[model samples]
Structures are given as structure tokens and as C-alpha cells.
Target: MSDPTDAADLTIEQLAAEVGMTVRNIRAHQSRGLLDPPEVRGRTGYYGRAHVDRLRLIRDMQADGLNLAAIQKLVGSGGEEFVGFRRALATPFETGGAQIVAGAEVRRLLGVEDIDEATITRAGRLGLFRPLGEDRYEVTSPRLLTAAAEVGAIGLRPEVGLDVLEKLDRHAQAIAKIFVELFLAEIWKPFQRAGMPPEDWPRVRDALERLRPLAGEALLGMFEPAMTVAVEKAAERVVERIARDAEKGR
Candidate 1:
């Protein structure tokens, strides 16, 4: 069926013509309780924007491979909650433009003299690069690329940088699962168990919208102190080793 017609009321036959449906089909929908009863003025029941909208929704549900019986059940059971859930799920987590760099530039950034086929394949597997052919790649996460470059500047080899990334990626995935499970258990399950109240939909969606940045900030906040403690411990070991080497030399 076509989109709901301009905010004007129409007769059943007029609505059928407007929405590309037969008059018989319109009556059948009304019989199935799929369409709302029209406003009756005397003997002739007039259809309105609401009727047009409901008809359009039925058409869409049918197009999505749902049978009439299923559509009836779904529409009878609050469909507004489904729409709210979809909107909440569609909330974006991250936003950034991808950067394309030549293979030579990539090598330079990683402080490598050359990039072998193996290195390219490994980077692709790690989701760091998408080969664009002709020796160019799309950097999936520019922030990660920048971090690799900084580490490379401090004399870490490209392979070593990739190794660190691979290990960190495993930890990152686990961290993501933790947050996702937390959301499902603490927020989503309660909402679902509550029968997904219409009025509470906004609160659920707002919680989803707030989750992403909160997760990011929490990770960074924890990582900072952890990194500092790790560095201090590593430096102590290095100093002890240097002192032992000096004693041996004497």
C-alpha cells in the first residue's frame, strides 16, 4: 500500500484507489480487525489519516514476510514498543571518518623499511587495514593507527606493535562483552520483564544512548592508573638489572 494520504478523510473506495488496494481487500482488512473502524457519518463510514496509516503498516509487515495472522497478533500486541526498541538499538556507538593511506606511508608511520605480504595479511586480519589494491589501505581506526605510530617512534618494531595490538584486541573484546552483558542483565532484562511499558521506553533508550561514551570513559580511566603502575614496576626491574651489571663489571 502507498504512504498515508494527505491529512484528508476519504471514502473506503477512495482510500483503496489512493493506496493501490482493492475495495474488497479494504473490507477484508476491516473484517480481520487489521484496520481501525472508520468514522461513520449517517450510513457511510469515512476513513481518515489513521486508517491510511494502519493500512500502510499492514502492507509493510506483509512485505517483510509476515503472514496476516502474525501481523494481526503483532499489531494487537503493542507495536509501539518494537519501534522504540529499534530506535534504541540504532543509536550509534562511535563516529569517525576512515583515512586511506598509501602502503609507503603506512610503512613510514610504523617505522618499517618494508611491508611484506605477510605483514599486510596480518594487518588485514587484525582489522587495522583494508587493502584498497595498488598498495593503498583504509585505516579502520585512525586512533589505533596513531597509537601504533607513536609506539613505533619510540623504537618498537611494526611486528611488536601489531603483537601488542593483537593482545589488546582480545582484552578489548572481553571488556565489550562485559559491558554488553551488564546492560542486558541490569537494564534490558528488567524492561523486557516489565512488559516493555510504553512510557518507560524513553528511559530505556536514553540508557542505551548513554552507555557507549560511559564505557569508553570508564576504560580510559582505569587504563591510565594501570599503565602508570605497570611502567613503574618495569622501571624497577630495569634499574635492578643495571645495578647487577655494574657490580659484575667492577
Candidate 2:
């Protein structure tokens, strides 16, 4: 295999071709300050593996629903500290908590003769199963799948479970937005205003990495009590309806 470091020799045109991007797009990124300027040798600029990697990283983040401004914050001045921060963030939050299972097997587990396309689409939206091919899927969370299977076994339609998942997804999105705004206001903006001193970049990265688990813990801590209150209120409503029905019968 060719040495990956040899990418440093590529010209702008070659680098753009190698990364499956248009030269115009590469120039656009440079103009937007999303990409660092290439190395200069007298008259010509040469791109490197770092540039290629950064381009790919930007594309991946775009696919993950990040806007260019969010991507800029994530790429973060192209320092080594930023690279480490990106790597840490790239690590799957869910890790080894899921598995790939055949679509037929998933249907069987759910006690369905054949799952409908709408159900599959809903499952995908819920991060339960991502389609791998015609009949294969990556189960994103086994625990979630188990809960769904239990609901199915208890005679609940998949639609009912999917409805609950839709509500959870909205709530999760709102919570994420709140936390990101907090981080931007309290942490990132202050650092930016101070010119993001190089010595402090590592600390900033560390703060972000530390926030991941803490954020997860905080969300769960808040969710449990909220869930308890919701369930209690629902149960109370059920009891009130039953009492009213008994009075009517009398």
C-alpha cells in the first residue's frame, strides 16, 4: 500500500479529484474559512492528507445534519487539539450497545408475518434499525428493540410504540438545542471573544469531552422524574374516569 503521508504531494486539482470534490467547492470552503490554505512552494499550492481528511470530516458532519456554522465550530481552527476533540466526539455515543440483525428476523421477533414499509420507516426514524441492504439492518439499540418487542408481545400495535418514540424524539431534540445554546452562550462565545488563545484550546476541548457524559447523565436525571410525574398524572386521570363511570351506573 502507498504511504498515506504521500498525499502531501498532491496539487489542488489532484486533491479535489482524490477527495471526490469539485475544485470550485474546495475553493469555496477555503473562502468560507472551512479549509486551511494549502502549502505554497514559490508559485504553486500543494494539498495534503490533512486537507483531504478534513474535507471528508466536513462532509460526514453535513450528512449528520450540521450546518456550516456548526461545522466551523466543530473543526475549530484546525489545531491538533481540535483534531483530538473531533475524534473524541466521533466515537459513537451508543458504542457496542447494538447489533445487526436480518430484517426477517426482526419481523419474526416482533411476531409479524411481514413487516410493512411504514413500520420499517418508522423504525429507522426511531434509530432502531438502519437498512443495510434488501433484507438486513443494523439494530441501533438492543434495549430499545427489546422494549418494542415487549410492547408487541403485550398486543400493542407497532404504531402505538412509534407514536411514543415520536414524542421522545421531539423532546430529545428540544433538550439538545437547549444544551447546545447553553454551551455556545456560556463557553464558546467567551472563548471566541478572547481570540481563542492557543494555550486554552486544549482546555476547551477537554471541557467539551467532559460535557458529553455529564450531559447524558443530566438528561437521564431529569427524565426519570418527569416520566414519573407524567405516569402518575395519567393514572390519576384513569381513576377519575372509572369513578365517574361508576357514578353514572349507580
lDDT of 2: 0.79
TM-score of each: 0.73, 0.64
Residues 1-250, model 2: lDDT tens digits: 2223634677888887777789998999899998889889889998887888888777777766768887787677544555565577677666447788888879866667787788888889888788888788889888778877887889988778778778888988898888778878888889889877667778777777777787799999988999999999999999999999999999
TM-score of 2: 0.64
RMSD vs true structure, all candidates:
4.4, 7.0
Position 42, candidate 1: lDDT: 85
What does the lDDT read for residue 16 in candidate 1? 92
Estimate candidate 1's alpha-carbon lDDT, on a 0 to 1 scale.
0.81
Candidate 1 per-residue lDDT over residues 1-250, each given as its tens digit: 4344444468888899877789998999999999888888888878878787678777766666668897787676545444555556765564556789998988888888888889888887876777899988999877788888998999888899899989988999999999999989999899879866667777777788788889999999999999999999999999999999999999
Report every candidate's CA lDDT: 0.81, 0.79
